[model samples]
Target: MLQVFRKFFHSSVGVFAALGLIVMLAMAFAAGDVSNMMSSGSITGGDRVAKVGGNTIGTAQLTKQMQQAVEITRQQQPGVTMKSFLAEGGLDLVLDQMIDGEAQMAFGRKVGIVAGKRLIDSELAKIPAFQGAGGKFDQNAYLSVLAQRQMNDADVRDSFARDLVSRQLLAPAQFGAALPQSAVMQYAALLKEHRAGSAAMLPSSAFAPKGLPTQAEVSAWYNSHKAAYTVPERRVIRYARFDESVIKQSSVPSDAEVAARFKANAAQYGASETRKVSQVIVISESMAKDIAAAVAKGESLEAAAKAKGLSVASLGSVSKADLTIKSSAAVAEAAYAAKAGATAGPVKGALGWALVRVDAIDAKPARTLEQVKGEITAALTEEKRKQALAALTEKVNDDFGKGGALSDTAKELGLTMAETPLLVAKTPAGMGLPAELASILPAAFGMDHEGQPQISELVAGKSFVIFDVTKIIPAAPAPLDQISAQVMADIQLEKGSVAARAAAMKLLAAGKKGGDLAAEVAKLGVALPPVQQMNLGREEIMSRGGQIPPAVALFFGMAPGTTKLIPIAGNKGFMAVQLKAITPGAVAANDPLIGQVKGELNNLAAREQGESLRRAIRTEVKVERNESTIKTVTSTLAGGN
Candidate 1:
């Protein structure tokens, strides 16, 4: 309930939406700005990008957030274009939301709400992003990720704490119990899924609403939403993107270097102790008591294991460290029931009825130096190769920077210069190039451009680059010859529009009379498969389902076996559908939304209750900022959309 959400929202870390922030963190990484390393710059907008008690938000932070939103949006509509996204106001809205969020965060701090380490750690623990394959907090993984993200422990702790504080302020106001439960449930459904019935749909063709304005109608509609038809300005580009990967073929590691690396990181690279054991799973403690009781009364252990839903495994002997069973106290207690010579009995484990007879156990011993030498050699050699590769890349970049041509460097390094086909500023088909490349590509075609190796900032790594554009192609509209067949098909489909409408109308009338849509299709000599049920969710209701007909989504909300007509005016073909039984899709709502309004509301409540407490602490702290600098920075980034 919103009320329940409200009750916990001001806790500096609530049960629900902090998890969302965590989810967003993963998305931010996938969006390729997980580091957010730059929070100290200015923007184009007159409006300050970040203002916290006059300590302006950093440009680096602003850019990272923008990049994060861009990445997340791309995931939402993968392969979406910048022009299209900008037209939709999608990227601008996302950017504005982020800036607003940062402002609010500053406001929260000024108002005297601070998140503590305990809260930060608690929330971090719950984040699935930190959990490794074993499903526990993985320190190594955390370190590697943080390093890659250019994050330190302190920065993470602070960011996490701030996010928690934000959540504490926002969630409760959005869902507080002062609102009626009905309101909560209503919002819940709007925001979530309901498991129930299936649906079918009726389409516009059936009930052709008569508004034939001749050619005038089409022209009018086009004029109203003319932005949709307007051509996007594009650029012709010649770029040279060069990275080490394309040019370098991996070579086998030298035996000496591999051996060295293997020895240096031997603790990390070597194998682990593995074990084999049998398992018994049960539900209740009482049932486990019963099973144990029976087993202790001279029942065969195999029988006891069989009486329970357990699977047995055989191993000559395996190391204890390798056994998953040994990792648990419950399993350990059960397994250790007997000495090496004896069998253990009806001892309980954490999950269920688990009794272990230590069939065999092997102690882990250090691997001999000779036995691991080859692996070590290989690993060390690879490390050397990586270092060499990195040095080579740096050398090439240095050469490129010092007025050296890509061709010149390629020759000197014994590297081959390869060319990419035309990739205009706006059109990129390669997996490596992103929309941001548009900004960089123009420079490749600008003054003093030719033979000037355009080294780009490292994307995934310091070594990565988008190679030079070998060809520049201007955007072209479909040529007559190329689109002749398509034009003919369009002419046929367009000309048939009147007849199709008339026939579809008759079917709609029949469908309203409870006739099967399939029956109508048969009368028209067109075939369609019988309706099959599918559960549609936010992620699935897409263009891929784009072909399924708009009726797919609209019909799911209709009553079973009923008819409701709708129109599909998009890229996929037009379709008609009848409402089948409503199959309510999913189960329960998991979490609540935390918007800026909700957060502001939470802050007001916090202020009333603990204003004096926070004021006293803030009065003891010192804060100063250069407002002019911040204003200059944030403004450049503002007002675009």
Candidate 2:
């Protein structure tokens, strides 16, 4: 969503992105407490990573944030590791964000900007993490999260307060900031620029050596790349589904119970009558009489009222008592007294004198107890069934709480216990896993190996499942001998990739030396795919939707008359891309796209200006780095010193 802004302010956007990052980190810790995700042994107290103004950033704090950063990254890249994250500069990124946040807080306080407790509390309440099932800020839920994270109210409040203060200091800096149309036009033209290129794939298999890879080569490759072949952990779930049928309590209502229920709701079964009527009110009795007389003398009440400069209103299906409450007792009596289709009266009503015309009369004769017996019995049975089901579920939960086993419960209740095939975190299509079981996988995966049985409602108030993790297959690499054939094939593919890259580099070099790309591709004796010609505007590529192919992306990124090798993902091959022509994009002053681009760029400009202000503030705030402690923290998280 902020791609354009990030591009426009690449040097300064990290602080802006950190604004959201702090809130996310705070919310995540309060929500799930990912603090326990890493080993506690990595943490050593009393070391400071950095000092912003007078406040010190602790080693533990930086480590916690890094762990959360890794967990958040894993949502998209599940295979991410602490070592890989740090290798990609994740530690510095997280620590820098922390420093930026602390700088904002220090600067705000230095200038006497105070985030009041009530304001901080209001912001805290808005975090979905602190909310409950009712979607409201729940005090118990908040306290429970604090307890779980081993944090106090003060700890949670202080974090939220920092965020609130930062916003207070930064929001106004970018308020309503915008750029002129002339400034946005140059960037918009880049989107309309046209480019043409030709690309050819160099498949490594064409140049690959004949025959199988040596056994030693396969073994060496497998040993070095074993992590790639490691299977993710899987769990086997054993469960028993039980509903009201498994409960021994009777749900059927006896005759006496049904009779008592019918008696209690006697008025509901009694005879009743109502009339749908139309009425018009006038201040004077004379006007009311005129309308009523007109209505009786072959004119519809609506037409009569409309002619008198009034509108008739329908009182839909009102009984006498309801009509009396709405207008007057006299109006009600007159309305009910007249038969269907008859005009009632110029009666005095609470509103004024009224003319009432009956539209329809509906009546129901009272029903005897026998006539309603079946309905009453059914109602009683359903009520009893729900009560019994609730009790059974409660008992099952209580039993589970008391260290009861699911298998023992199934045997006790005469229920069948079933087991699922080893399952991963995500359900695959055609797995035929029951939807109820699928819904509980997150909870299941959260449990330890062979954790205690838990009772979960499959269908609220109707069905439930008692399940436990019976078998856990830890993630480990398959032995080389078990996958020897696959390893040999992979070794061959790697050789092909190496050969293909060589061919791609050769072709690229030839093109750079003023050789024709198509002619050079033909010279390669290997069976090659035909060269693909592409002519497209940036707008045209966007219109095709989805991701632009990598080779095409490389083509657009290149200067005209340059050749580059684009490596294919998964070691497939490479596409040697050569840019042949460039057509500059033109935009007329009156183009509507100019206005759109102007608006989008203005918002991005405002955000960039806001981030620029934050950067300026950080500079003003005296920030001191303890480089040795920072390295120690990162090294510890990477499983080092």
Candidate 3:
């Protein structure tokens, strides 16, 4: 149990995952603007969202990763926004992670280290994607991956190499072996055990403090932490949030329009240049050459192909434009260069191909409206609907700035305004608030003088065209009226705790003299609960020190049925607890529990190994981050002026 907790808690997975996610985000955010994508020398610049070595992590790639991230983030937090999450440094944290990954990879290359194939295979086997229906590594599936994702053998090798290097460099060094029996015992104790004990709550209304501060102490404390009380400079502006799906609103297209579109694009609906051909495929070049030789010797191509282990097959009724062989550069060049029934070269294809014959050809004809009206209407209607949505968005945002707010504009459009409070500058909570609302939060903090409404033109993904800073709550030290009573109550609690301690030894002496536990406790003039048999484990009772106490460790250490006085650590008074029973546990072999334990142990070991590896590499690796630059950027962003 102790080991599992450690593995989950201390694994370097958080770090590596963090790095990968961050790098992906950097690539996404850095490449946000498409206009600058091609001409920009590299995305490592401030304008760049992410960087790898000197390579610009293109916005296109970043966008893809960001979309994936957005989906994952949305899954985790259905209503997370760019503003609220960023206020808590989510974006910054993500950016840092990405940058760390990029830097680490760059650093890895600087050294003469390469991730080994063994490491790649070991890690690749861990991924569920490579598994078959039975959950084991599937060789066919593995080959299919190479075929499907357009990955050659080299691509797979590179992927494996990177995965291994990163994993080796990243595995956390925090994993511990043999989850210290002591820790496991301690953790297990918390669940099954607790010491029987009692605490008297001194009512705040019954006691008071000495030497009240004249606001000077409060002011001093507040001054020392001035930065906390200081409200960051803010901006007041107008902006509307837009939902990305606004582009899909309703727009009915006319039948005439659909018919016209169908007429204009009739060819795209159905067009084909059909062809008929024959092919001979051999496994080897020598056999293919011999087959070609035989075909040229007055021997039939099919007979020659059969003799050389080649398969003679015909392409039945395939579109010439869609011919697999004709579409291939290598295959097409050889096929087109030959006359009808002429022999072509041993043209190897993506799979493998050789000599071919062109038998016949046929062309397709365009269809009438009766044959394609339904499909045309659907396409035309969709296009019209898309255009209508754009117009709707423009109308909404334009109405917003027409000397009116969203509410007033909404009212004009026969819409209703829904208002909500409890919104923070960084995190705009509520389902009504879009995630994009957060992307402009930094800008919101920069708005000057509240009440002036500023609206967004239109941000992609978000469709709302409005925003306005409603209020600003300046942070200040709590008033004495609000805090003094609480402070006085705290002082009284301390006094009560001291009073309780002053009576412990006296109570202990009386209990030793056969004074009833209930009678003696009552003699103190304090109301207490009846004595109950509480057999708490070491961890359980200790964790509840406030209520039950870890002093129970010492209490349990006492002989069964015997009472012992144990001092409370970092608290008031000693407790006399009577022991009831003790239970011990041992690690079992052949128990299903052992497998779970082993997995935890392995993870712990991996973490500790990764951490150790990182430490060793740390001395040799150099890092130079412009933190001041980053902070300044943050401040500049936060402080609008």
Candidate 4:
């Protein structure tokens, strides 16, 4: 238990260190933007968002923490935008985490859990982010990093102190969790248990109405689900692109240039001499001499090795430079001197003594310049184009800095300026953008209308683009007249699914009452698909065949011979499940699996206990929240204001 607590404490401290590094990097990157936003009065004027006991969580502190969290999330999900993060409740999650941390700190202070200045200083010294090139704590590097992030030394020390206090307060809950042997064994057995069951699918298409859906029915369905039919907001962008391929055709290398290139890189166009050799290494010089003598007597190396309880190794085709093994230079020299089928060597090696045999020799072949002219010309052309593109990129960047229009720049540079089709954040296929441009969809769509042009690399560094959004098309529902056919089809599918589910239920009920399921299905004029045997857990069963309906998971806990009706594929079909057999897994009391299960359960219990303790502390201590201030901060961080 003490070991567990020690491990947890170390891991928690490591996490705090990582978070601190992220905070520094994020603050540095977002300093200018955050300063501008704050100056614009985007955030409501308030010194603090919440007060927990005597500890006040200031708005500036919360905003800084939120920025760090956002940066970490961005690293994990490369293309995530602020809007998507807010929609996913990222702000709420960060707020809860901050509040919890403050609650823990407050409780620690009340209980006299103090982190001394000496401990805090020691931790700060050990952080790699604060270290210099020599891998030792450098006060200059530490101060420089803080200055870049607009943070001072006192702010960092305070943060470290709070982290230590929180860890100390939560140590008891994290370390006290333990599981009984019986519970561990039971959980392990449950995880190992496997059940084999069969299911028959009843597709909705089999029960689809022969008649078309009425106009009224289509309209009714459309009215109720208007949001589903709405097209998401999209953007039209105008951009100028430059790549290696865009370099002038006249820039092709001349024959003289190609010849010079080939001459300069002669080794690349010539094949080196290689030898096929076999060797037998032994622990002693006598053993090596005996093996060489055996080979000299026309005995095969393999046979000679077997007689000496050793193995012969084939070096395959290798050049002199490829012989990298210890003492291989002498081995190569001897092997190359020997004629094919000749045996040589009783030479000492790093491992032992060696006997070598030359199997075959391949001579070097030099390629004529004409034979590699095409490759050389292509390389030269690529180099010239890269240089030209770099110059063009620099000019375009200068123009952009001076507020020159992209279209005018494109015209001046003889580059094409084109508008992209209305593109969504995901940029679905058939939008007609080049494959390379597809990668920039997230950046393009995340921009506001008429926002500054962003430069992005495409095809690695070989290509570059400068683009700006030309128009924004807000999301709205399509008119009924435009998608009446699709709406009617959807309505018909829904009705068919309902009918299929009813038929499946009837079959299940009949089977439970000792009636034949297949016969009953046939009576409804529908033929059930053959039963498929599956051994799966709840999640696996639910995800089978693209998307399995939630109802099928009920069979996981059912006994053998139980019958159930389950919807399938999100209203695309229905299924009748008959539990065929259950196989009990044998779990030993002393099994390693039991220990693993116990460890997982203990970790979960510890996390839950920590959460509960935080909640209890929050309730005991008075907490005052400024709701309007939090709203303003949340909006500002989410880029809504």
Best by lDDT: 2
What TM-score, to 2 decimals, does candidate 1 have? Answer: 0.38
Q: How does each model score on TM-score?
A: 0.38, 0.62, 0.42, 0.58
lDDT of 4 at 592: 86
RMSD (Å) per prediction: 15.0, 10.6, 13.7, 12.3
Which residues of candidate 2, in runs, are more than 4 Å off? 1-193, 203-208, 247-249, 274-358, 429-432, 545-547, 584-641
Which regions of candidate 1 are displaced past 4 Å?
A: 1-74, 78-273, 279-354, 359-366, 416-448, 454-641
By summed lDDT, the worst window of 10 consecutive residues in model 2 runs over 29-38
Instruction: For residues 281-368, write the lDDT of model 2, one tens digit per residue.
Output: 8889888889878877899989998998999888899999999998899999999889999988899887788888899999999999
Against the true structure, candidate 2 has what lDDT?
A: 0.77
lDDT of each: 0.49, 0.77, 0.52, 0.71
- Per TM-score, the best of the predicted structures is 2
Clash-forming residue pairs, model 2: none
Runs off by more than 4 Å, candidate 3:
1-259, 271-367, 370-382, 395-523, 537-641
Candidate 4, residue 123: how far the Cα is off, in Å: 1.6
lDDT of 3 by residue, 283-328 (tens): 6888888887887788988888777655778866555445554435
* Candidate 2 global TM-score: 0.62
Model 1 per-residue lDDT tens digits across residues 205-288: 333334443444444444454454443334333333444444355646656655665677777545554434554556676766
lDDT of 4 at 388: 78
Clash number for each model: 71, 0, 53, 0
Ranking by TM-score: 2, 4, 3, 1
